[model samples]
Target: MLCAVVLNAAQAASAQSVVVQPAVQVRSVTTNNVSFAEAEVARSDSVLIVTPRLDVLTVNPGYRLNASLAADAVTYLGRSQADRLLPRAQADLTAQLVERWLFVDGRLSADTTAGNPFGVLEDESSTIFNRTTVYRQRISPYVERELSPRERLQLRTDHSWFQNRNAGGTDTRIDTYLLSQRASYELRPQPLGLRAEYTRDSSDYSNLPDSSVLFETARLSAMYEAAPQLVLTLTAGSDHARYSGIDQRETLRGFGLRWEPSERTSVGALVEKRFFGTGWAVNLAHRAPFLVLNADMQRRSTTYAAQVAALPAGGDVAQLLDSLLSTRITNPVERATAVQQLIAQRGLPATLASALDLFSPSAQLLNSASLSAALLGVRHTITLRGFYDRTEDLIGVNPPPLFSSNARQYGASLGMTRRLQPDATADFSLTRSRVVGFGTNAGVVTNNLSVRFGASRQLSLRTTVSAALRRQWVDSTAVTNANQTALSFGLLHRF
Candidate 1:
């Protein structure tokens, strides 16, 4: 069913509208012999302006701007009596400048929140309130300028800063800046083009033992259509990174190509060389009717180096040989060897460097594969897929119970996705994974089950629900170590 209403009686040539809405949510959690529930109610209001004339701001440009301002506040159960539910506010303005070559956009947002852990407060385990309000604000501004015909240049800069103050005596701040320059050239229209870009990144940290880090990257690429049905692309780039106060340096050189013969077929490959870095990898994937497969073969090795921020012990001595023998100094501007820079980079202290070998990069090999197939037939409504995968990482996040000389993972999965209706669908999947650590501890195995249901009616209404369950165990522990469950539901309406 469709309903349409039209009114042409507005007195002005341009008009605006304001919209207000509200919502409420309830939540519950059960974990590790602990169960809790909470409810929250929120109110939101928004004002929007619609310009009927194309030239609402300036008659010469012939454009319109949509601007909106919104604010919301929510109150949740269980909180300190002195605390207040601070409201969040936002403002947006999208302006069309010159209607084409140049445009501007801006947005601002702010919000606050409270603390958690009810038991800690009730039992007086700690004297602290464990909660404090934080203020977050941001703004984004951009401009575009056209350089010439057949060739164009673009420059963009972004700046952001954050400050955090604790109720106690703790305080911290962050400032970030980014700049990008890009140029696009049409060798023979857009079908054949060349592109180049360069970017620089720097970070300075202060507080306990202040430090700074910086990096520069540049890339050049060309893409062209060899045939109406075939397209090819190639790209090359390099990156140099320097750790802040540590004065440590890392660099990477990479090149790759991608080819697409038809809408149904594609292939791509890439290789990279690194300086004072980890390792390298290879990846590949292909798709076909009734069956789809992807595989990745990779090797990675990193030194058991200590954190530069907390240097403990010197790592394997082989790093000295790797650095002196492998890395070559090359000048970017002169395109010549620059052994002086290499010697300078080597002078920095390794204490504040990665726990890995400072002189050499670690190496590791990893492989993974996955597959899926159309269940019965193309005309058959049901689809089925099965996938298997594995990974090999030398280090684990946890050193003790999860300790390993090399970590290995294995998994297999089965999935069924079906169309229940033109506008609705459902899917179910199950997967099992096993992880074996190189250490003496027992390996772990986990099984995951999930289901999803979704419905959509164009722009009017949509609903989706997904649920997951999992069981995990370690080879040494014989119990149902952990049983987990989760679910999410969402609904959206447009008018």
Candidate 2:
């Protein structure tokens, strides 16, 4: 269905450009702790992995698309775990249905997720049994109309589905629907504007029908332009919600400010009072000729699927590096490809600050903050990433005792890469993370520290060779402490 939508949208375009890229990699991995257990009980193993990927991109006046599919075939020489196949895919598409009046956005993604937050964490090549594949799809269509020179209206509807492929009696299929409307009118020649908005959101769980939720909100706001680059707003709203067989009515009052002094810098913040007490969000971003910085904080009631969808397909590190190189790379397609090449050449991680996201049927009040920055020099690149997350389960039906309440996780990483030659580079990184659970899981804590060094060289325009060495240490109060050392070598070819 989604492919049909893209094809239909492309047919309406006057001009279109398409590109497909295919690549493959062969890797040899050696690890001393195959099961990530205490050294006394650990076993060694040799693993071989083959990965193949394909990416497709299309762009035109009426539509745009970026998609990729990949799979990992893993084989173990030593019998610590069985062989497995891991598949991953992601797609993002936006199309103009009727020029400026109608538009549609669609997304699809699939990946493996941890079954238990406290379980051993390892890469896809590692034979980890406590993992499951998750898939999510979303589509949104919206209408926009210009009522006058200073007035506009927008109406939109969004539908999404979340499925857990190996769900064990839990809610395996979830559907979410949302409807929203907004209207704004600005007084001509004056710095005043008024806006009205309304939204309705519903979520249904196939296996747990009683756990569904409906939320409705109506809001009004008045905005004043304080300066050419600054705006201040005051808002009032009401919410009617039903969850966990309970109903709620709340008044919402908020204030917000936005400052965009230049195209390279922006800052925004909002504070509101809701049924869950004080709620707020803040964002800051700045781009320079040689650096990029971004930081954000948010608190809201959301599902794990929603959080996963909001993240960049390539992760935070890729997202930051893409921004850092935006000025140097103007074309979107070229920039995206360049970002991936840099990540491979510099040994940068695809992801840096992901939390232990376990499956849950109920909603959660999540408080999260993240900061990322990249510095680019003539022959060197430096990156920093940090994140903190605290989640409290809300409206949980028959929640597991160990994960029924609050969980807190925080981590940080720093990496540096230096160019050794025109086609070779060396890099080093250090990372530390910790997680703590509350309530029935109180006193349960885990800490991880990792150090890595790697080097990569381009053998040709379409081939590369790389090697890496890593050591990791784990300290846990709920499980036995352990340490592991791993080495990897790989060859990649693109065609």
Measured by lDDT, the strongest candidate is 2
Query: 182-233 in candidate 2: lDDT tens per residue?
Result: 3333432248887778877666656555656666778788889889888898
The most accurate candidate by TM-score is 2
Give the distance in Å from residue 24's predicted Cα in candidate 1 to where it truly belongs. Answer: 5.4
TM per model?
0.41, 0.90
Q: What ranges in model 1 sit over 4 Å off?
A: 1-32, 35-95, 104-149, 160-194, 204-209, 219-239, 245-255, 258-481, 485-495
RMSD of each: 18.8, 3.1
Worst 10 residues of 1 by lDDT: 117-126
Clashes of each: 15, 0
Q: Kindly report which residue pairs in candidate 2 clash with one another.
A: none
lDDT of 1 by residue, 406-428 (tens): 33444444434444554344444
Reference-based lDDT, each prediction: 0.31, 0.74
